[model samples]
Target: MRQETDPRDGDIIEYLDKGRLRLAVILAEDGNKKRYRAVSEDSRELVLTLRQVTHALPKQLSPTLSHEQLGQELKSIRLRAEQLVVNVDASDLWELLVGEMEEVELSTLADLAHGEVSAVTCLSTASLLRDDTIYFKHRKDSLYEPRNHEQVEALKAELAVQERRTQSREVFLETLVKALDSTPDERGTEFDKVMTDPLLRRYMEMLLHLAVAGENATDTGEACELLEDLQARLDHRLKGHASRKAFHLLVELGHFSPDENLFLLRHQLPAEFDDVLEEAAAALVAEGPRRLREALELGARRDLTSLNLFSIDDLETQDVDDALSITRIPWGWELGVHIADPCFHIAFDSPLELEARRRGATLYLPDRRIPMFPVSLSEGLFSLQVGELRPALSFLFEFDDNLNVGASSIVQSLVRVSHKLDYEGVEDRMEHGSSALDDDLRKIYEVADLLAHQRMADGAVSIDIPECKVRVDDDGRIWVRQRRRDAVSRMMVSELMVLANACAADFCVEHHLPAPFRTQEEPDPPMDERDFEHIPEGLALAFALRRCMPPAITSTHAGPHFSLGLPAYTQATSPIRRYQDLLTHFLLHGFLREGRVTIDGESAHLALSQADAAMQSIRNVERDSGRYWMLRYLEETLDQVREATVVEYVEKRGDAALVVVHDTMMRVRVSLTRRVPLGEVVQVVVNQVNPRADTVAFRLAT
Candidate 1:
């Protein structure tokens, strides 16, 4: 008896070729692996294994036949199989065989289909089964497996979807190609009308998502395929990251703004409040006055509108949240720090409060501001504007002429701001300019100086570094102002806020209440004398000290803030700008009113985690967006050579080092041929700058 693996010369065979069934004629036996040398239907010569052969029909030809004769014979068999397959309904055959059995032999299937078991019928049956995506499958040998009803239905659905996707891709490609070729004038109104189609709109949205996520996009398969298609069709070569190419395409089609803020979108930081949040803010504005009057009538709230309270901030500041006051008593001076009461308006866990908690802090972008609260509330109704009576959580302290605190207290009060002053104006007048409050400004600076000396004596670490503030107007004009970090009026405001925060935090500890207490541990392996002796440059020295300090973190438990030299501290000053401050305000309010914290330690810890996560994203947006605009500034003034100070060298040979540009204050690594000493100022040219890519380079001026 002959084994099934044996194939006679010139036997007709059906075998798998690249996942498709192809008809082939066996020419000779290959003794190795028990495979055969064969000629396929396309007249291509190949070796086929016994496992790959789905069928070896009971038919033969002369072994001495020429190759052309074999090709002619294979073509005739293929033609007959094609003609027979026209009448073979795969689904109909499956319906007949599915209920009776799971599988049937190929020759039996061929006999069932054509009433005969021959090479022609078997090849025809195999061809029909191979092409049928649903109903039947041939895994191995000459067996045909009939799929169950459920499997067949699923396959049909999948096949239908694939067909629709194919058609959709074709239509989308045609529409995009036409749009890409359109004249600029034709693209504006008429092309926008074409984008009204839902399918095209979906494509534009996908591109926008890809642009925002950049290299981090998850659904990149379709995005990559779409771009590859575009690259094949377009005249100019597409380049750069896949996301940026999508961005370029969107800009070309007028679907996206050319200068779209991808950072905001990628971070999911909302640029504007929706209608619901606006309504919540509007409701707060409407209910604020009534609630203030009720609290005052209840008699725990103090009324200090008669006090000459004044706020100092930048000229462009709108959400002025804190003000200061001083008065002489028999033994000492009474100093008052009154903070605007936004937390008093927002109920705990309300939508507005939750949103504030989510934002963590107000994001100040170069060109715009995204406030923690809606503008109507943050800038208008809740801001401590001059001459307007507003509810405040006021911290009062009595200090001697030496500015030593004798006593301090916290109270919910009502106050009116008498003056709204800027730092520059106050700084100018405190020195010599004669203004009505010049004397008061001088006295406040003296208090600030006293507080600073006290903190330093308490082991405070002070590092002052000048920062460049960049602003872009609606007209697209860029203004860069260098701010002195230790200016007198600014210091006065800073020290006063620190005093209030420290005293409030002490109160929380006294009451054993949990709040958002900002804590910073001392620098590990703290900087010593040798660390400071190395850097002589003032800016570099200050920056190195800053690097030695550990970052401050917020917690539900109270602890020392080493940098501020405060035994206890909480940020309750900028409720208008920071969410954690507002939360602390809420905790303070409940303790002041009910003699207990409304939020437990666990709840406060949970809020801290959420706010910390949000604040990280906020910081990334601020840093990345800030750098982008700085790069843009460099691009704007690329012709000018900037003064860059050599800060440090990555290699001791000084072939590569980091430098800080004088005007932009951007620190970047530069390749250096000359051995530049530390703190040496060198003229450097803007060798390369691309704001969108967040890339910039500097080279020493030759």
Candidate 2:
């Protein structure tokens, strides 16, 4: 007798323990004695074993029953079990099941097997259950046997339906992805043929109408009314805000305007749109703009009063930049720093104001800009240009022993700005202790340093990341240059700007005006840890220990930005391009004049939300653009023998990984890593560079 294999789901088990029918292909007797059968037990589900009979058993009790036994006759029949080469009729079962029974068939089992195929396919023909309509795939808990024709047909029908539905969904998703990648023809128009096809359009329309009617419409007239009401409700929610407006701006650039863009941006209603839609867009654009400009111009026309005169320069434009006034008021000196009233120049419903509202703020990119306002206003009329008299809100801070702002006063004053000094020259004189602006400017720098130190001592973390400064020649070819922060060039400019911004925020909050403050929320702890994966095990642990201290408070009000370690941070310095700063200027100007901040708080809040979204979107665009250029640079450098250190390792999807080269932080896919430990120096030859994918591949050389 052959030894039995372990009885797995597909393994045949013999039950003829130690004699008589041992090794026999055990057959149980039925009413038709000509057919034979075997049975197996499943012990886990019941106290006594239950059997799955190989062939159909008789419905009635066998004559082997006795008088006493017949009174309590068993509901099931038992077959003498045995081991036989488990065989199943190939014609009766799927090939996927019994094909693996022999070495010849088992060789290609992976290719032949499918998720839905049965395991009985591997069995030989001798195991046929022809007299009984046997179910090769036995489902537990089902009482009805496959011997019943209706049950067999029902199970097959369910499987077929499910397969069809799954295939249809997959086809639909593939088509959608393809459509996303498709570009329009030379005419720059893409028709939604699949979506707007006559048949699909009619079906969709019917479904939409049915859905509306189901929500309490009694008759056709009532249904139409309900639909109109629902449409109005949806339109209100879909009204485009700054974020969606900016997205539409991009779509316009791409030559593809979605429905959301059409509905919200009626002003840019394509020439194709009927006159009604165009008029509606124009009206919306006009309303908010008209109000904003009326307010701005009112402030701009005023003159500075009750303040000592300061030098003013008239640049070719009058867009307010900065205004200064010095006064010896009573016991101490008062310095008035006035800014232009942009809110005055921007009308509530003007096109320029509407565009500003859409953009939230100007987006600064490496090579270009998507400005928040039209240049005519941002850099011209509303600008507090050098030598031009413009209205501004002044902050007079009284300093005593330590030069700290002990007492402060805010005023709305119309004053002319002195010469506009760029950071480069202003910082140079201060660093050299030059007498260009008196020693007073040097004293300010000294106080600023002290403030920065205090911030760092309070557990602020500072990470200095290098940026690749690209200098593009006239031909548009980039010259990669290292842009490192210098004390006078970068740090000083940053500190003063922060000081201004912090002051502005304090002013707004103290007066109960809703101001858009720039703040950063820290990443979650788990994500923070994951970002350090490429670091060496030892160094990573050291970094983790150093930064393990919990932050005192998640929110910061005043003092140095814990992130930058600078005291008194704010950014009111740039009004020409940034709308937030311009708006801040407006609010400050209003508070100076009225003793309280003016402008709609709700509108300001909406503007802030829109600006943040635009900021993120622009950042993504910048990062991708920089990466594209970096890849191009690497492709050019591939031929030269370049020395690099392994700075990091990034795990890519299966069978692939990225190795970042030190200094440049450029990543390359390397095909070998079985022996190389992370951070260990290994030479590599650049094998291929794909500029299109923005990726490079390298061969690891020992």
TM-score of each: 0.90, 0.46
lDDT of 2 by residue, 170-283 (tens): 443343334434654411222244345543333223323433233332434532433344335334332242233223322432433332212112222111323543454445
Off by over 4 Å in 1: 1-87, 95-98, 111-124, 178-205, 230-238, 293-300
Report the poorest 10 consecutive residues by lDDT, candidate 2.
42-51
User: What is the Å distance of residue 185 in model 2 from its true position?
Assistant: 20
Q: What is the model-wide C-alpha lDDT for candidate 1?
A: 0.83
Clashes of each: 0, 57
lDDT (0-100) at residue 159 of candidate 2? 68
Candidate 1 structure quality by residue, lDDT tens digits, 241-294:
899888888777776666677898899987788899999888888887787777
The Cα RMSD of model 1 versus the native structure comes to 3.5
Best by lDDT: 1
Instruction: Give candidate 1's TM-score.
Output: 0.90
